[model samples]
Target: MTPAAVNDADIHNKLRKELAQSRVLLVDRHPEARNFLRMTLSAVGITSVRNAGTAHEALRQARNARFDVILADYLLDHGRDGQQLFEELRQQQLIPLASVFMIVTGERAYRRVVSVAELAPDDYLIKPFTADQLQSRLLRAMYKKKHFAEIYGHLEDDAFVDALAALESLLARSSEFALDGLRLKGEILNALGRYDEASEVYREVLAARVAPWARMGLALALRGRGELAEALVEAQALTEDFPEYLAAYDLTADLHERTGDLTAAQETLLAASGRSPDNATRQRQVGHLAVRNKDLAVAEKAFGKALDRLRGSSLRQLDDYTNLARVRIDKGDIAGARSVAADLRREFRGGKGSEAAESADVAELAALVVDSLAAGRTGDAEAAKNALNAALARHDSLANRRSTAVSQHLAVDLAHACLAQGEEARAQALLRRAAAEHHDDEGMIDRIRGVFARAGKEHLGEAMLTQVSDEIVDLNNKGVLAARSGDLDAAISMLSQAAERVANVQFLVNAAKAIFTKMNRDGWDEALAERAQGYVRRAQAKDAASPRVVSARELCQRVAKKYGVQLESAAKWKKGTDSEAE
Candidate 1:
């Protein structure tokens, strides 16, 4: 006896009427599964359905078409899985907010991963479901997305006030969407820096039901409102109740750090790591915290774990290798540092060539210099120094004239290498340059000061760095005065010239803003647009993790749009579920 096919004529007619023009994509490794999905879709009057057997093929199909509905299996062929594919698509901005992404999985364990994800699918369905069940989920998802379009547009435009108003209207108009509207309203309020209002909205949600996300939002809102004790209690309770909630762990650790409980913060992260050991981002955060605490053992262990997780993935970065090597050198384990440096060299050697190739080569040579100095291999250190100089010189010639992609961390590495080679004057000059470029950044200044102390020249480095810092600060102050005087062009010129002299991210961001202001007043100029983007790109490369840099990046996108310049990755942040809205 064969299994009977699902035949629900009334359900098909209803779904078809509701989703008349919908385009669907089915991703499954099994041909039988694809055939079954296609038959189900066809029965529901959805004839435009594409099929892909692998994640890569599915990605290709998605890129080629704007799919209204994407039904992906939890497990795909080969190493790739549906979750990874979904993340890649979102990262690349290949998927739109209005589209529905469904996780169709037979495995019950898939729910665990979905529950804690920062971004999850719009809907999920367990396998072994009837066609009627599939139609019901799809219709609900489509209805929500369609109804939320007006609020989404305002939110995308950064019009939080307008978005809130629209959400209020939606709630008043349809009780069916009250929870979604309230959730979105809370997120918009949070983004607008209205923590008090956001907290109220979140409390309203909690009154309706105990949602993990709402609880997280309430904690974040409390923190934003400067109610640390309250936020701490909520986050603590959340972690105890839902240990799988990664955000709760992160929030708990951050609050502990803010309150000066470093030990507690470390323990919280360690506990979370025990639960989800494969999360590279959490491992990196743990390593950074441990390093700040001067706990080399914990830092080393966390970084090693991160390296293992990042291995063979595109997410692997030079910082992971450099950070681990730095820790080893601090621990006086020259052999360990040498091994890490060798691994770094191998990691970049086979990579596809990019403009940053020269920078990477120079960084590798600088790392070798550290390892050589630690081992007392004077000749090897000298060779590495020469190679590093050659690499820098090549980088100078190859770099774009309009771009100042200065990496302060790389400069610190070179300064350390120069000090190792007994070139105190050159080392001092390099460190002074970095300090001058990042004068307003107390954290970067402290890091530079620490490096100087490691070289036994703390007093001398401090005096030189202070002098340069004062000079740069004065120059920036003059630029600000010019901007305040309504001379946008003059402000841009002053700040941009200072940026060229110092390769400062602050100067570049200011100049970019001034240029944008000028363009908005005096009409768009292609030259200014290009120059602005160059500054944004340079700032991004120098300090990608900084919130200031991220804000600058967002402003650059707005400026690009104003000037009709096409930009990539212009989306503000990750967008998928309610969590991303916050």
Candidate 2:
């Protein structure tokens, strides 16, 4: 036999050995289909199997047990499909990472939807496939997940360097997994903020083949490098080439927004969500872009659909309800707003003392405040103001135990309420507190500015912001002068002191630069390295997309390399934006 044929035979035998002891779940509404899957799996010695005749039942069984493989049919009862179920399972994180999911569809058209989803199954099989075909596809998925399990574990733990090391070891040890390892390596490099390295890997992959994933990765790398126009061209080309790919649409939308084209961004997400209606996250994103574009009708429709998708799933969030309510208010549908607000309060009434419940209280009161003002009911508006004050007082009493992040959110909500009730002084105080706590968040600053601008308090808000900015700039100038005068210690001290007083991105970046420059001049200090890393990470957390922040982080990484020390990348940050209401 030829050497290639011998290797193929060996691989087939290994797959059979692995499948013999696997645990499986079969989800098909038809009894005949379930029987076929059962018989086929048992023929391969996969005896530990279960069956579910509906999507609801399948979800329950899948959550109850950690099956190694799941074969789900495309069509289920009650207008639901296997793809919807799969999306929900992933959205709610109900399935284990190692579990292999495969879709079984009778319709050839099903391929189009699966090809585009952000969370697709491990594999898929068409109807009329023989037991042999099933075994081959299932075995391939199982083996891939098994081989990369360690790398996946490292990624889950946010250890990007360790994950890259594991991927590198796998690539060197075997050529069979080279493509998979390279794909993972690209992802890890992007996560570590090493866009140049990621771009190189993607370029190498595309040199060998015209791969869509590689093309998308290259687009992201371009964006990370601040080449927005190039990234936009690449993203637009990718969307045209692969119209069904959901992620390409997302990339296109982001690029559109970055280029000040909110209308295009809104249209892109709206079209993508129309194709994949079961994706709640995409629906929420659509609502956000719509609101940003001032399309309240579209925002309401999108949020309503998102709320429907979140029904009977563990993926529901308080924002889903609040967003719908706020959009309703924006659309002048006060009754709808009240209904949604009531539903939100009822859902969390059981957990009154919990942080989430308190946040819900703030949201509900904020909605009521807006509703009252819209109806021209001054008395009701004043009542909401009192209630809001009571809630804020209670939250502040427990502020010592909760995070300042929670307080920042509460403060914003309260500030909005204050403005709606015409309490300018209270609103100004809350705005100042929010600014002091979250000064670096440009999105929040813009959102607060919008709120005041609507209330004819724009001058007041801008005055306060200008004062804060002036103080910060003065401090930064002093630190810069110190560094230029050969007093690195004084520069670092001043910058660090400013950062401690108010967590802003510019201050953090300044502190990081001084600390790293000092480390480069003097021999490395582990403590100093740690302190500098902390500054860069804080800056990244506050503003990862800013070119200035990205450049500062890259410089720190270069310094760490020169000193032969490791500098960990910051974990991804999730900030609250104005669209959180959507």
Candidate 3:
């Protein structure tokens, strides 16, 4: 044999040895298929294997254990496929970046599967493939994972600076994976808000070849730098050329929204949702945009589909039911709205206890408000009045727990119902609470305005929203001014009080940032650090992906590292449900 052949043999043998030590998970609907694959793996000296018959089971196993390789068949039950499952796993961070995920499919479905997936798997295998082909692909993917391991480690720790350095080192070597390294570098730069560098990196890639991801990255970079017109042109061109690129559509929709063109945004989301009907996140976005555009029919369809797709998944939220009901009520479908309320009650009937019970109570109260709205529309005055009164009586008890969009929407709906009953004081109070809690959210503010307009109280909404905005600004400025003047103690106290008063993401993040700054400057105070951690948790619960929240977290992490303190795991700070990219 030639020298190159000999070297190839040596590398193959080493990879085989490593594969024998790897853990694998097999996912297929057919028992025989899994059995055959397991036996094939065992024949190759790979004995550590687990099997899951469905996507849900695979997710459960993935959550409990780390697997080096996951091989899933393309077709699964419940109207889902391997591609969708892979998307879910990545979105939820259930699988580490270093793991290999290969999708197995029939030859006929390969093209469709490859073209439509928003995120690609590591590799693909056609049915009736030999053990040798699987092994070769697995070895290649594992090698790439090893090559990027350092960068992945930095990313997992949220160390963007270190990750970029690692990427630069890898790129400087001009290795076979240099293109992939550039892709990752662009992502990290964009995440760090370094739009100019990101745009340059993506442009370099585009100059080399017509890569879809590179184009998408360029559009995102442009958008980040406020070059919306150029970004829209690039994104629209990508969608026109490669209609299967769903991320472009999302970016395009966001650009339209930024330009205050809700109609165009709704149209863009509608097109994307139609292409990927099983994507609950996109469906929810469609619903939200449709509602804003007053396209009730589209809103109803989008929310209904989201509820259906997320029915049995852990990702389902109470917002799904309430959003659909609200759309139905707006469409004048009183009976349809009532049916959704009934489903909500049935879904949350028997709680799991403790916090679960409290969640159930919140859902129940939300459903009551929906039903009362339906009753009012149907002229059942007595039923409407009673339900509305009961919801109002319980409102104060749950006020402090209103941290999510669901609760905010509930407050708005309750206020709308109160206005219908001519209770101006009660309606104004609910509106104030919702506005104060979500002061930084332009979408929620717009929603509150929509409710006011629908009730013929647009003038009242302007004055009330102004008051709430001013109050929040005053609260934030006082603490900021105190901190700027080097009064750390007073700053911490004032910010903490602001957080206590509103519990909004802005206030909570500010409070945590102030505490961490003080801790970083002075000696570490365990009590103060604990309070800061609490504020961070609260802010995360409200909006974990908020830039402000992320900044506060990074500050806390730096302080903890300086003090040699071992903080809690990042996973604990994540919300219970899966979150999608914006």
Model 2 lDDT per residue over 1-582, tens place = 999999878977887887888788888889998998899887777888999997767766765666788889877765466766775565344565577889888656465655443236776688888877888898888778878999876654335566788888888888976766787788767756688999999999989977777888899989988999999899889878777666788899888888889799888888777666756677887887787767889989988988876653444566677678767766767778778766766665555456666555555554444444434333465566566666556555545554424435445656776677676787787787677646665445766786687678888889998887777779889999998897999999998898777667778888888988898898788888888778877776655555556556666766777778765543222211111111
Model 2 regions more than 4 Å off: 1-40, 47-67, 70-99, 110-121, 146-150, 153-157, 169-173, 311-313, 351-381, 397-411, 432-443, 466-582
Name the lDDT value of residue 578 in candidate 2: 17
Taken over the whole model, the C-alpha lDDT of each candidate is 0.71, 0.72, 0.82
Candidate 1 residue-wise lDDT, 354-456, digit = tens:
6356545655654554554454443565565675565446435534543334356666766776676676876787788778877766545766877777779
Task: Give the residue spans of candidate 3 off by over 4 A.
Answer: 1-18, 29-32, 52-57, 75-81, 112-119, 399-406, 541-547, 575-582
Clashing pairs in 2: none
Better of 1 and 2 by TM-score: 1
Which has the higher lDDT value, candidate number 1 or candidate number 2?
2
**Between prediction 1 and prediction 3, which has the larger lDDT?**
3
Separate clash counts for every candidate: 0, 0, 0
For the record, the alpha-carbon RMSD of candidate 1 to the native fold, in angstroms, is 6.9
Model 3: per-residue lDDT, tens digit, 286-316? 9998898888998999999989986756656
Model 3 worst lDDT window (10 residues): 573-582
Best by lDDT: 3
